[model samples]
Target: MEAFDIAGLCAHPDDAELVMGGTLAREAAAGRKVALVDLTRGESGSRGSPAVRAAEAAEAARVLGASHRESLGLPDSALERTVAHRDVIVSALRRLRPAIVVTQHWDQRHPDHGMASHLVYDACFMSGLRNYRPDLGAAFRPRKVVFATSMTETIEAVPSFVVDITATFETKMRAIRAFASQFSPAAGETVALPFERFQESVELTARRQGQRIGVTFGEGFVTREPVEIDDLLALRGRSI
Candidate 1:
């Protein structure tokens, strides 16, 4: 097993870059081995072939300093929580052996994003079971799972915490720009949802999250359990 400090499961090639690129970049810069997993090839997207998306993803990973990135090749726009769908992630969890795993929030406008969240949640539990899927690899479960809410225009829930990405905000933009096929809006184009001013969408969301925490740039994350604090005085950043 190639132990990783952090591993993020994304619904598509650019999902992580859009939402948590800064967090990933910051962690990588702090000497943590960060990796990314794209659940689908994004063949169903409006623009960009799978090959083009994969190449862009590779470049984005390089820009973010990720140790590596893998794609499960799951059917695009057809994500499900079936056993087979979950097995691939189970195998990957065992193979990579990450200490922390991050994925999309369960509540999302896109069904695939929600499905990916559930799939990752189940895979994490199953991967820890020694008797379950023994053929995959040794049992290993990440200690923490984080949910990112920056993918959507409306954040429905209050963030548990916001990462101050002020330092790496530009780095995040560079990574987002790597997926030129998707983020680059063509001239004289008016559209909806993704691909229609997608780059602007990402930037606006980041700015909103940053303003909440009184920072130049920020990425918000949610956790199931309360974050334990050993010393209140040691906690940094002001209240929103």
Candidate 2:
């Protein structure tokens, strides 16, 4: 219920950590309040039960140093941009009143990810309407909405900005690995790659994105609107 400087809204429990864990960690480390809101309990996941996923999500939140975490218990994979759904998210926006919102990219391989993006985008707009959902809370809207890349491979669309996360990259991986059910193979369950190899792939992806902005590790984000710069000299002079 507390206000947060940044809020992450995503389809499943681990989506936030996978897409922008380092950024979240960096924010918290810098004394910024952060929260995570999962649209679903990830009940329909192939490996973990909903309760297990919830516990894992809690652990991950701790690793990221988030102030709070909540789940909407929405139907996983079948999420839609219904008025009811929007109202729920609108309520959260009004309650948390985050200055910045981080969510899954609009273009993602998973249908749920894309649907979640639409749901958050619409809810953010509706939340600002004074006449809308008065029963939820006072109307409120986030100052900015940023999309974290969910693509596992290269994509045509380039990121609007990249956050240097070299210092928090390891913490990000720690948060992700908290979901043992997802990244770690259970007994008798054959995983495509060992946990170490899977982690290496994630690190490699961060390294590749970091190379874009001349950092050791980074996270990419896209914004629909152009970012404003009060002073051009304030920008990091890192080679593009």
Candidate 3:
């Protein structure tokens, strides 16, 4: 089987960029294959049009140098945890064949984000079963899966691993700012703060995670199982 590095699955348009853009940029800079899959198009967002969001996503992906970025066409805010959704995610997993699958940690704030997490987690398990979705073509089982924090709620996601993206922090922010439609509001909007202020909320959360591990910027992830390594020294080179 041809192995891949990281495949990120999320609910909204910018979830991956908000959570792991730094790590994704760093990984791609290192020549690792990274793919981003969105469960929904953020069509229901109060901010921008779908076409505008799609354009912004493309720009953000280019900034991150992502190998692939696509959406599953699931309902943005009305995502449900069902076999239908699971089948869609399973097909992508089989096709991408990632060594590490990253997604949002379960959060109660938004149903779409939370359901996206549950659906991906279940789909990862179902993807490994040959009998579950055999007619789809082939079944794929990834070695590991990690969940990114997508909400303000403290999910208590004990990190099975961490990636230090301090060197790429500036690049990450630039990539995030590429979604200008989402970050900068249109004129005549009397909102107390611009969208970029909300974007900083994401940055602050990541910075907090970085502080936990003695790094300038980091992304935290929770795995279903403990991460195994060939040598403990592997961790010595990077912040975990």
Candidate 4:
């Protein structure tokens, strides 16, 4: 199994880039292996085909400096908490052996996003069961799991930590813009996304989140329990 410092598993191709590209870039820039795993091809999306999305995802991964990217070949917009779903993630966890895993928050307007959250969480637990799914790879689990909170209308996540992304914000934007098919469709596309000035919205949100931590840009993340801290002097988010 190839060991990785960070692994991101999300519902769709652009999900990882949208939520945690900066954190991934920071880790990769520091010589840590980062991997991205998508649960679906997003074939049901109003804009872009699966092939186009896959191409864009590859480019985004390159932009973010990720070491590996792959999809689990699950049905888009129809994710469920099933043994089969858990099995695939368990196998990937065993193979990748990532120390930390990042995923979307459970509270979401998009049903698939919420389902993906539950699926990933359960899969992480199942992966550690010694006898669970013996046909898959050996039992393995990530040391930590964190949920990313985006600038969405339906969610109000209180972040446990905020990653200062001032340096990597541009890289993250470039990664997101790689999906031209989704953001720049031709005439008569009629996409459902309210993509008007999405770039500005994203930037503004980052700036606001950054202000919370006295930074220029940031990305917020949440965890179910308290984070373990060894050194009280090592905290960075406090505004001094």
Which stretches of candidate 4 lie above 4 Å from their native place? 189-196
Regions of model 2 farther than 4 Å from truth: 150-156
Which regions of candidate 1 fall more than 4 Å away from where they truly are?
A: 183-190, 193-196
Residue 103 miss distance in model 2 (angstroms): 0.4
lDDT of each: 0.89, 0.89, 0.81, 0.88
Cα displacement (Å) at residue 208, model 3:
1.4
Question: How would you order the candidates by TM-score, starting with the best?
Answer: 4, 2, 1, 3
Better of 3 and 4 by lDDT: 4
Q: How far is candidate 3 from the true structure (C-alpha RMSD, Å)?
A: 2.5
- Residue pairs that clash (backbone atoms under 3 angstroms), model 2: none
Per-candidate clash tally = 0, 0, 0, 0
lDDT (10s digit) by residue, model 1, range 1-240: 599999999889989987899999999999999999999999998777789999999999999999989999898899998999999999999999999999998888888999999999999999999999789998998999999978654445678888888888889989988888875456876556564466677777888889888887889999989999999998887764
lDDT of 1: 0.89
Error of 4 at 4 (Å): 1.0
lDDT of 2 by residue, 1-240 (tens): 567899999999988988899999999999999999999899888888888999999999999999899999889988988998878899889999999999998787788888999999999999999997699999888989999973444463577898988999999999998999886567898877788887887888788778888889988899999878999888874653
Clashing pairs in 1: none
Candidate 3 lDDT over 142-193, as tens digits, reads 8777887534374656565567878888877887787777656568767776
